[model samples]
Target: MKLSIVDLSTVIPGETRHDALMKSIDVAQHIEKLGFHRIWVAEHHGAASIAGRAPEVLIPAIAANTSSIRVGSGSVLLNHYSVFKVAEVFCTLNELYPGRIDLGAGRATTGPITDFALQQDRSKQFRSDSDQQITELVAWLDHSFPDDHPFAKAPIHTIDSHPELYLLGSSAWSASAASQLGLPYVFAGFINQKGTRQIIDSYRSGFKPSAGRTGVKSPEVILSVHVVCADTEEEARRQIAPVHVMYDNLARGIIDAQMPAPDDAVKKLGGLPSLETYMKGSGKPPRFVAGTPDQVHEQLTQLSNDLSVDEIIIQDMMTNHDARLHSYDLLAGVFDFI
Candidate 1:
């Protein structure tokens, strides 16, 4: 029943990346004041619409700006960098903020093309072993390794504490891995909605205890999805039109740095003859929820109950900064978060 925010640091057209980042901090502070649980920034590369390409660099500024509500990466693409380096960066953050930081890692890439670009820029291997990365990351955080291991000889500087770690994913494989490792798991319902009930069930049923996850002997699950809340259900649906258009554009290889105005997006939707039909179809369930505050609250509550999750993290892709802020405020009031 806990609520949290996930900011994509999405760039609005006509605004600089600085503006988006500043808005991110503004949103973080706003939610913290409203008594939300946490605000996690996302990682997106080669996308003009997303400004949070480097969460490691942004986390410090955000943590400094907000007094409470935990601030961390929605995920650092673990496949892109070294485990030791990733551990070092977050370890430093934890040293500064102590218990106020989180380390959510995932295996997402910007795009197939961007994958090639990142590998070339870093001059490192592109393929990843998420299990190995997680094992090493936990080992580094604990400053413990098997007696015969190389890291045992040259220990990384130990900290009095470690950042709270969570595995982020939209797949069953990820659920199983997080469960087996006894780490908290976040299911990206917005990214992929198919078979989520089964996924959560699998995660809980498969959970195993580990020294690294003593804080969570049982499975901890959070369901993250896109949400657009407004004063009226109809208005909310209209406001989310641009977001739907944005998804369609991305699937078609079109990327816009800023969210197109909802009115404009409605007009553009006419060109896609099958778009309306797809929206009208009842065969596939939606990956997002758009409604008035009360309506959204009901749906979100039902979603959490259905999946038996501990928390629901809201992800909003709306363009209007004030409206985006208001959405969280409305949800807070509905959920009695304060």
Candidate 2:
């Protein structure tokens, strides 16, 4: 029943990226005081709506501002970077924050143009070797590289401890990869909710602990889901209206649109349907959970139990900053996190 958070540093309408980032630090401090376990900022590129384009930079900022909450990347896109460098960065962060850092790694392409832009070698086709990257990254952090390996001589050891590592994903392949690597798996349920149970079950059934690695003795799963909680069901739906519109805009190839205010989004969408009906009619895996704290608690508890996950990481992108904080605060009270 443990709860954590994944913040995207979403830039609300009329807000600057700087505003969004400072708000992220405020969010980390707010949630830490609410007794949440961790807060991981997301990494996205070339998206005007998202300010967390580099989690490595944000993690330390958030960690320095908070006293106890674990801070890390919701994921650093491993496909775009070198495993050695990624390991070194997190190792350095661990040296600073000690046990309060986590390195959640995953593979994804931001977009064709941005992906190409991220490539160091324009002459070569982009490599899709995140599987190998994850393996090597773990070895680097664990200092488990073989004596003959080229990276064995790399001075990448941590002083006191290494950041806790988790594999972030929304697919069966990621689940299996995490299991093979013997790392904790975080399923992005907000992104793709279908086959969630099966994917996590597969991860657990196939898990093989990495020899000489110092974390995750057994398969551990954390489910990250979108949620909007309020004092009443009607209010929750109102708060969630902007998120619905944001998704709709993304579907329509409107990538640069900032999140609209809830009332404005509700007007744009011609009003929202009842939560139950909206979820059932979407014909897609439920994209988000929205309701009163009691209702959200029930749905989240059911999702956690059904998937047999150890923790739940809540992800929400609401336009109203106070409302967003309020949503989490209400959930904390409901879950008795404080």
Candidate 3:
């Protein structure tokens, strides 16, 4: 199985967009050389850490810079975007990058309550069903799947085929949505690990084939993992300190926690009660892929089986280009030949 790399190289706290984009481009280009299958950029709004908020613009920029790596919005929050516009955006991207474009749409807007509060008026309309929203997005894509309607007309660049579309869901809500619509489903193994098996099971077992999809043949369940491999275990641990801080910030409600200092986060959320029950049921355990390539690879080999994962998506929290590049070098040794 080929492994892919996804960089949530969000805008570090207090960093400018220009700086973040430059850093992201550097990372993307380096990973392309590293032979990652696809490089996806996530979209986040109202947060300092995430800068691809305007995926409409950012995705193309990143796609323009790289040649082979697949580029896409890790998701364009479906709830906040119009179906036609979202379809248009991905269709446009497909035109530019051809088969390298993917549309990974999801429900959450990346925050707990902030997304709920930002909606224009849908606070009550069609409330509480991310599955429905995902379904509608698929319908919008298939709007012209049956006939070449004017508005639904495929862009000239999108002539031969539509972009490979996938649903991004953190919970089980999208299982039915993706299966019924005949689209691939990507679980956000990063945030919530709850009911992942049941969700994947439901998606695989309940899927029905369509002209657009391969018909749920062992649906693609991409697990998000934090990896920081090095020559030695101690080196790996020190490098991965940033990842733990990143994790704490995410769980502690710093929706935009890109690279906050570990000390600050420890002061805020260190020693909090363990949500181990939740961890056992749905979420993945802490993934600090810091170790010799051999050790890290062994752990990931077991991780794939433990999670029944079809594909692994690594999110490198390391900031330094050389350091992450070194980690990537070790990672290639581990996952490249697979």
Predicted structure with the largest lDDT when compared to the true one: 2
lDDT tens digits, residue span 1-338, model 2: 88999999989889899999999999999999999999999999988788999999999999999989999998999989978788878888988998899999999988889989999988988775588888888887778778999878866435336788899998888999999888899998878866777788899999998775545778888988888899988788888898888778889999887788888988998986458422432223357888998888877777666567769898988889999999989999999987
TM-score of each: 0.91, 0.94, 0.80
Q: Which candidate, 1 or 2, would have the higher lDDT against the true structure?
A: 2
Q: How badly does each model clash, as a count of residue pairs?
A: 0, 0, 4
Which of 2 and 3 is the better model by lDDT?
Answer: 2
Candidate 1 per-residue C-alpha lDDT over 144-251 given as tens digits, one digit per residue, 9 for 90 to 100? 678899987783455446788889998888898889888899988887776677787899899987676322677899888888888886667667777878888878
Q: Highest TM-score: which candidate?
A: 2
How accurate locally, in lDDT, is each candidate?
A: 0.79, 0.85, 0.65
Name the better of 1 and 3 by lDDT: 1
Model 2: CA > 4 A from native? 153-160, 276-285
1-338 per-residue lDDT for model 3 (tens digits): 45677665555545676777777778778778877777777766676665566666777778888888888777777777566667767887888788888887876644546666656675464344566456655655555344554545545332344677888776766777778777777776656554656677788788777654322444566776667777876566555665566666667776554565333433444432221111323335354444678876766676577667767777765645567778877777677642
Candidate 2 clash pair list: none
- Looking at model 3, the pairs that clash are 11-49, 193-282, 193-283, 194-282
Clashing pairs for predicted structure model 1, backbone only: none
